[model samples]
Target: MAVLPLRICGDPVLHSPATEVSDFDDDLASLVQDMYETMAAAPGVGLAGPQVGVAKRLFVYDWTDDADVRHRGAAINPTLWIAPVPAGDADPETESEGCLSFPGERFPLRRSPRAILQAVDAAGESFEVRADGWLARIFQHEYDHLDGLLYVDRLTDGHARTAAKVERKRGWGVPGLTWLPGVDHLED
Candidate 1:
C-alpha cells in the first residue's frame, strides 16, 4: 500500500465528476489499498478518490474512535437515499468539520443523525448499511465527493463565515478564494 498525495482545495480534479468503476480488478483493489493508506496517514476519518486526484467513484472511511486501530474499507459506485423519517436532535449534536482539501478551515455542518446507504464493495459485493452520528455524517460527506460536491457547498452563509474566520485565526488565506483547477473559470 502507498500513501497518495491529497489534492488540495484548489486542484481542478476535485470538481470533476468521477467516472464509475467498470471493472473490479487488481487495479481497483490496489487503488483502494492506496486510499486506505493515504487516509490513515492523513489521520482523517474519510477520503474520496477525487481528493487524491483520481476521477473514479471510490471512497474509504472508518469512523471508529480508536485511532490506533486500522479499520478501513472502500465504497465503490455508492448511492445514497435520505431516510424517510425526520431526524431528531436526540440523536447527536452538530460537530465542527474540517476537510483534507481545505486546510486550516473548519465549519459546523448539520447532518442526519442517522442514515441508510446502499453500496458495493471492492469485490463487487452489494451491502446495505445503517449508521448514525459521526459515522453517518462521514458516509454522506464522502459520498458527496463521488458526485463532485464538497461539504462546504452545503454550508449556509453563517457557516461559511465561520469557516472563513477559522481560517483567518489559523493564519491561512481566506477559504474559497483559491481556484480549484477544473473549476477556476467555470464560476465566472
Candidate 2:
C-alpha cells in the first residue's frame, strides 16, 4: 500500500459529504489499505476518505486507549451514534484534537464521551463497536468527515476565529491544496 496525498482544508472533497460505498470490490480494499498506510505515515490516530481526496464513506483508525487496548480497523459506509457532549467549554488539556487534513494543528473541541459505531469491513461484513473516551472521540471525528464537517467546523466561536486566521495565514482556504505524508513533515 502507498501513502496517498492528503487533501487540505478548502478542497471540495474535504468540505462536501462523501458518497456511500456501494461496491465492496478489490479497489475499495486497496483504498482502505492505502488509507491505513497514510494514517500511519502521518502519525495520526485516524484518517478519512475525504482527507485523501476520495469521496467515499469510509475511515481507518489506529489508536491505543488509556487502558492500553489497541483499536485498529476500517469502517466502511459507517454509521455513528454519540452521547451528548458535557455542558462546558472544551478543555484544551483534555479535549484537544488534530486532523490529518488540517495538518499540524490541534485545538480544543467538545465531543461526546461515548459513541456506538456500526459499519461494514472491506469485505462487506457488518460489525459493531461500543466506544468510550478517546476511541469515542475518534469515531465521532472521523464520522464527521463523512458528513462534510471538520473538527474546526465544530469549534467554538473563539477557536473558529483562530482557525480561520490560521487557514488564511497558511494560504490553505482554496482548492487544489494537498500534502504528501512523509515528504511534508508536519507535526501536531
Candidate 3:
C-alpha cells in the first residue's frame, strides 16, 4: 500500500462531513490500506479518511494502551458513543491530544474517558468495542472527523482561538494544505 499525502488543517475536505461507505468493495479496501500505511509513516496512533483527502467514513488506528498491548484496526462507517465521565475527573481537558491533520500542535480538550464503538471491520464484518482511557480518546478523535469536526474545535473557546491563530501563523488556514513529509509530528 502506498503512503498518501496528508491533508492538513483548513482543507475543505476535512471540514466537510464524510459520506458513508456504502460499497464494501476492493477500492474501499485499498483506501483503508493506504490510510494505515500513511498513518504509520506519519507515526500517528490514529488517522481518519479526511486526513488523507478521502472523504469517506473510514479510519485506521494503531494504539498501545498503558498496559503496552497494541491494538490495530480499521473502522468503516463507524459510530461512537461517549461514556459519562467518572467522579472528580469530569474535565478531560487535562489530558492533551494532538492530531495528524494539525501536525506539530496539541491542546487539552475535554473528552469522554470511555466510549462504545460500533463499526465494520476492514473486511466489512460488523463488530463492537468497549473502550476506556486513551483508546477511548482515539475513537472520539477519529469519529469527530466523520462529522466535520476537529479536535481543535472541541477545545475551549480560548484554546480554539489560539489554535486557529497558530494555524494562520504557520500558513495553514488555506485551501489545498498538503503534507510536509518529515515535519508531521507533535513532538517536532
Model 3 TM-score is 0.90
Best-performing candidate as measured by lDDT? 2
* Model 2 agreement with the true structure over 1-188: per-residue lDDT tens digits: 89999999999998999999999999999999999999998889999999999999999999997788899999999999899889989999999998888888889998999999999999999999999989999999999999999999998788999999889888887999999988886533
Please, what is the whole-model Cα lDDT of each candidate in the order they appear?
Answer: 0.72, 0.92, 0.84
Candidate 2: C-alpha RMSD to true structure equals 1.1
> How do the predictions measure up, each by TM-score?
0.77, 0.97, 0.90
Estimate the Cα RMSD of every predicted model relative to the unseen true structure: 6.8, 1.1, 2.5
**Candidate achieving higher TM-score, 2 or 3:** 2
Model 2 scores a TM of 0.97
lDDT of 3 at 37: 82
Error of 3 at 19 (Å): 0.7
Position 140, candidate 1: lDDT: 83
Q: Candidate 2: deviation at residue 121, Å?
A: 0.3
lDDT of residue 7 for candidate 2: 92
Name the lDDT value of residue 52 in candidate 1: 85
Candidate 3 lDDT (Cα, 0 to 1): 0.84
lDDT of 3 by residue, 1-188 (tens): 78888888899999999999888889888988888888888879899998888899989899887788998899988999887755432243557888888888888776788999899987889989899888998999999998888888777677789898888788886879788445544434
